[model samples]
Target chain A: MTVTDNPRSYHYSDNFLDFTDEPARSRITKFEPGNAAREQTILRKLGINGWGRWQYFRTCFSDQWGESKQRPLSPRSQDRFFEALEKLRIPKDSKASVFLTDEGNLELVWLDDADEQVQIEFGPKDFEVYIEGSGIDDQYSYDRLDEIIDRFFAG
Target chain B: MSVSGTEDIARAICSDKWDAETGILSASLFKGAETSVSRLSITPLEDTWTVFRKNVEKPPERLLDRIGIINVQSLMDIGSNFEANPTRLSVEPDPLDGYPSHAIIPQKISRGLANKILKSLDIREEVK
Candidate 1:
């Protein structure tokens, strides 16, 4: 096995579940890096700030489940997620929103004008990023938080 | 999870079956390609029930009880076919919500659709 930092060395995901029971083609593009500032500017125009409101949680969790299950995100992981975004440096500009997992992990989803979606869920140990498009879905994992972020920017 | 809720949710998310050892409900939501699917899982805490979401896609699953809470230490061993994207939610014990937290993310549904689902699932308000 080869060990390297380059994405070219990394393998494309082989684990895909086609509940449709048919072949699916992935929809992802690797291109020249774009400016992060532009993506940030477009994000501002879109008006998304990772949903900092507690009311937002109240609305999403709704009182329906009604249990102590809903605890606030810890500053440690929460800050890590915020820090992870800066590391994401996704050159691709798209509509993005952030949400929390039940375990207080952070999730950020971005959509381009083409309607493709990229979802990232920050875990305590590592982070996962999945890109969705046309006929295919792909997933990638990294031991370090920034590792996945770099893949987001590169591919 | 009655004794171990870890495997319960894991199996439910992948296989849609209940595991007696783990105290998790069947709350898995898949949309678009596998990359875009959201997850919703539930576990009974000592006093309350915990629900986990990856991307908020659809209505909640039928709630059920499992054996017990699994050891968090052995969670990595549970093994999953898909990668855990940091952009979505993960289940855990906490007081604050994740980025957007439950009922958010994996947002392909229209606001009208989201509201409709919320209205349908809202236990606080009786659906007419």
Candidate 2:
């Protein structure tokens, strides 16, 4: 049967009954690492040595340990990230690469971080942030910086 | 294929149509509604096929734009969006792969400079 026909049955059949009613936004806000060691293992598994592309080598440079992109990690951004790290539930294992977006200066891509597969896109330079994935695609423009940080990052 | 064989496949894609219920882009290779053995395929795995497939989808007239509806377009778009603009990636193989070394080119590498980098890395551009 089509998914819309009987979502309950479909969920039971696909074993997606585990899917939570809690929103992807809640998942991002409530995320917290089990421990530092657990997060380190994930970085190691995902290969921590990402480098810049040969063609666009300069702008997309990365240290791979944590930083990704030519620009050094912003002190404010890093501090915010550390604060988020206390709450964000990083996935156990996945192909997701947490990197910085280059659209308008380096932005945080807390991309695909949770079990719900939520991807958040944020930019301080251009004053824009958005959250997407798990079938959700919404935007938070330059005006909503404080709201985004308080809702999604601040615990 | 010969001139006529190529023409037959094009006709099938238009008249006979495609079987895109599956993600694959397959059009009958022969003229008639003959056996399904004769078919041409386009998959997203091959890097260059997209350039041609994209060309096919450019004509905005078709009511049923097979290429547009198929999920492969999104796959290619997302992949291109990500890989075409990546923060970091390295081709240097690990120690197990004989300690492959990569050169750090200058800030702005010329066409010739890029060629030299590839040559130094022993990576010949695939002769298409």
Candidate 3:
């Protein structure tokens, strides 16, 4: 079954169920390392599809490493990116990759079969988006999580 | 041989700069400061792929396993705003010991231009 047809069943086949009704915005206000509740809240929302990318984010954060300088991943940017991922689940068939930028921000890139691409660099106060496909190649700046979902993620 | 726009340049790609499953390279491989021009090190192929791959090394933790190849003309021909706009970016030799083919792109690279550049690359893995 397609993801939209039976999301719960599809998620269950992967043995990952996101059990939360809380808004992603509320949980991303801050990132506390030892805060289990906060971590679970976001992790569960990721389900199976995003678990690996989330792990990479955690790895980059803890690594505190780069070639030129000690450019560790930004905690606030990580929180914002986590919030974005919570809202926009990567489809099982599609691929999404995360990267640590030189400016200490997190970039999430999503690509699908139709050649649709959405790339967002999560910053402390805002995020930048690049959407390309079907003759549309444009960039936009957004601050709210819901608007990003509604504008880009919504079908 | 000297570096030229007609020749291709190669750069070491760490594990983080590319995705094995998707076979897609991250534009983060080209990110730099937003203000002043920053230097990105690359090696001109100069008809010696084996030697270039052997000499460009990285730490064990950051394995130099993948090499991304793109023509220098591609960077010089980077498009902007979905159009062909003139860019001020430039590339030149900045050789160091044991790396005579070393070159550098001395400019502030935007994510858009980086994306375009990576899209034009031929990435090979297990270089070393």
Candidate 4:
């Protein structure tokens, strides 16, 4: 129940999800404070402003769910966020595209220069690694579909 | 019908240079669309505060309704924690109950990747 002021604090919440099923390795690089500043700067550079456009919302998790965290933007926010993101710099020859799943979760796909795929889920309250190396986890993927519309409206 | 227009308006607002006049324009445009416009403006703090209060009073009710559930849960959890260890609690009841309950740790995009992306965006000049 500690409230953190830094946007990077959200990164820990990202790690919490990344490590939810399997504990994240200590070596799994943690984002430095400066990186968060960079992200804020990037957001600023991309001109993300005001509510419902690349905005962050509070999310409450039941005790059964471990640590609670705020969710990223809703589908609309996701759309606007990524649209702004499209204006951002990504790796060379890598393509980035975001999709809102039928269930309302956001799937961000980053294709490496070699065309390898990395997929991540951006849900109402957390972000999780959904797939890597071209495999899908349908169970975890659709488990929270009903909540998508809810999060979209909430954002 | 107005949804797409609103979306366009949002895009315009996002991409616009953040100046006092643009802020005023944003406030007016957003207000016309029935969205909260106070935050979109760069007016004097007092004027902005007044607008913010009025603007948010009846927010996108649909949006507020959804966020309200999350807020309620957070408040209840905070209340429970206080009951369990009131001595450890320091802050007063949150005025904005919707505030996130946990700390956020920032994550950095890989430097190599950031450089690549920056180059691709053609805004490397802005990336000092």
Q: Give the per-residue lDDT of model 3 (tens digit) for A47-141.
A: 34345545565554443454345455667776677667667755556666666566667777778568567677887777777665643334445
What is the C-alpha lDDT profile of model 2 across B5-98, one tens digit per residue? 2211111121012222212111111111111111123222233223323332222221122222112222223323442232121111111122
Top TM-score model: 3
Cα deviation at A13, candidate 1, in Å, is: 49
Writing each residue's lDDT as its tens digit, candidate 3 over B1-128 gives: 33466766776675556656565566778755321111223433333445443443222343454667777666677743325334565566766566555667767666666767777777765433
Where does candidate 3 clash, by residue pair?
none
Question: Quick one: best DockQ, which candidate?
Answer: 3
lDDT of 4 by residue, A1-155 (tens): 45665534444554354543321222232343443553564344433332222222212110111012222224333433333333434454454443323223444445545555444445444444422343432222334444532332122
State the TM-score of the second chain for every model. 0.23, 0.19, 0.69, 0.17
Count clashes in each candidate, considering only residues at least 3 apart in sequence or on different chains.
45, 8, 0, 11
lDDT of 4 by residue, B1-128 (tens): 11111111101111111122112111111111112111112233333333333323222221110010112222223334433232211121211233221111122222122112222221111111
How many pairs of residues collide in model 3?
A: 0
Can you give the TM-score per candidate against the true fold?
0.35, 0.26, 0.68, 0.21
CAPRI category for model 4? incorrect
Lowest lDDT sum, 10 consecutive residues, model 3 chain B, at B34-43
Give the per-residue lDDT digits (tens) of candidate 2, residues A62-121.
222110122322333433433333344444343333333222122223324453333343
